[model samples]
Target: MENLKYMQAIVVDKPIGPSGLRLVNDYPVPEIGANDILVQVKAVGLNRADLIQSYSKYNPPPGSICPDIIGLEYAGIVVRVGSRVVNFKIGDRVFGLVASAAMGQYLCTHSQTAILIPQDLDFEVAASLPEAFITAYDALVLQAGVKLNQSVLISAIGSSVGLAALQIAKLYNCIVVGSSRTPDKLKLAQNIGLNFGFTVESGSFVQSVLEYTRQIGVDNVLELVGGNYLKQDIECCSYRACIVIIGLLAGIKTEVNLALILAKRIRIYGTTLRSRDLSEKIELANVFASEILPLVKSGKLKPFITKVYSLKDLHLAFNDLESNKYAGKLILNWS
Candidate 1:
């Protein structure tokens, strides 16, 4: 490590949402472990978790560095690498998801999970990627084992992760069913390879999805909006279908039918990258780096970024995210 120590950070000062954040100029820089790398962060991707975490609704894994800093995704250049790190070196451009402490100029995370930023992509775009794409890829491909010609339903299709899942499903020539409250957002999903999309008013899309699938029901679901949406997910799934719950935008607790789940033999999974094991994170990073990221470089996949805000405008970005109207991600540029 260099003599440089303190770094600017956005600290969640209290359980009071974004208004409680404090932009501190002298937060102590985090130290790296033997298998870690220190990054000079350039930009951050604001996740919904950051909002909830601000109000103490979400918590990072025990012992995560700088837990009060509100961020999960970042892109930057590696400023230093630990003794046990081999894949990355100083000054290599990289981006990845960490548990916390990303809304700052400096971040330290396990090197195995850090992905090299493609030569053609900038920090802001790279920042827009890790959280959304990683979560979608893990849920749809790795956990669910989505196959070609499968029918997949992705809720909240306008959200960043939902769009990422939509694009991945399209890669397999799968028929995608998306539900969003806003018609314009559904149109955006349709443009980005959504096959059957309609407005969801009361968190019910079972009729539309089953009708489109010829009553056979969808084979897989990326259940981004939980609460009432999950019950509908079970109702619309084909026999033995997999439902990966990636978010709880609708709410947490819900009234789900055990009989429906049992009768359909539905397999439901809940996942989050924030507190996953290191081996799992490393595996996902490798698969994403090799299989998914190349498409972005070839111009086949576009990372959705609604806007980039200066670090000074983070407060505004928080409110924008809370509005739930943006089609994609809101980035905070630390540079």
Candidate 2:
């Protein structure tokens, strides 16, 4: 990267449709801060948020240099470390998250936010871990404080975060039940240790969860599909159950029963990894490094990639994410 003038990247050149994305060879290579590290990105992971940002629906968080470049997580080698950075050096394998600008050949991120990628994981799987696994761990363990043997319900069980949550929840020995519109996805979740999997074909899964839990209701819910899913989550929640809202994929407007919420004394929490302060991101990264890294290194916790696409096939990657047929992450291989 020494004296390099520009780098290749996929940019949202036209923020109108799914095919609005295009590959450019001359996107300016990013610069590192005093505490940052310069990375040669090897693989990147796609999120629904990326497609939404390209369409001008959800803007990347503040301090983004290339809001037009859409990506949330990447895995690569550290080519340079900032002046104040001491933990990492050139050639260190790492993976981390960003508000935006991660789909490029090179990216700069704070050193504290980057997790060392172990030898057991390759760039494609490493790229897939940060956004999905970190988000699931942060929301379930750090934020929701889920405990062993607790009954948990995760909406959209086939989603990237949903699959990550299934594996993480089982690590705590939680009795996990998940809902998905796709039966195949539910089956996928079951194969990953989800205790019970149900389909919300009619937009409801309260009865299924209740019956599985013997009418006791779930103690925690990882709500990723919002909309009426929140209403069903509330109905299936046990007394004082904790429900953490992470995504609003299923429309934002939903008429939830405030009366039931009050009666059950349920606790509701909404979370997003983006738009967070730098300090908060560093804290979450540290938590992942200490608690989640060992499991990942041991192959007990792994990323479930739906498909791997080459950088030249950026359009197809976008279309696949938009189709939402996939249960796990879609990876863009740069190498």
lDDT of each: 0.91, 0.89
RMSD of each: 1.2, 1.2
Query: What is candidate 1's lDDT per residue for 78-185, written digit by digit as tens?
Result: 999999999999999999888899987799999998999988899999999988988988999999999999989999999999899999899999999999999999
Cα lDDT of model 2 by residue, 233-267, tens digit = 99999999999999999899899999999999999
Clashing pairs in 1: none
TM-scores, each model vs. reference = 0.97, 0.97
In angstroms, give how far residue 69 of model 2 lies from its true place.
Answer: 1.2
Count clashes in each candidate, considering only residues at least 3 apart in sequence or on different chains: 0, 0
State, as a TM-score between 0 and 1, how close model 2 is to the true structure: 0.97
Q: Give lDDT for model 1.
A: 0.91
What's the residue-level lDDT of 31 in candidate 1?
89
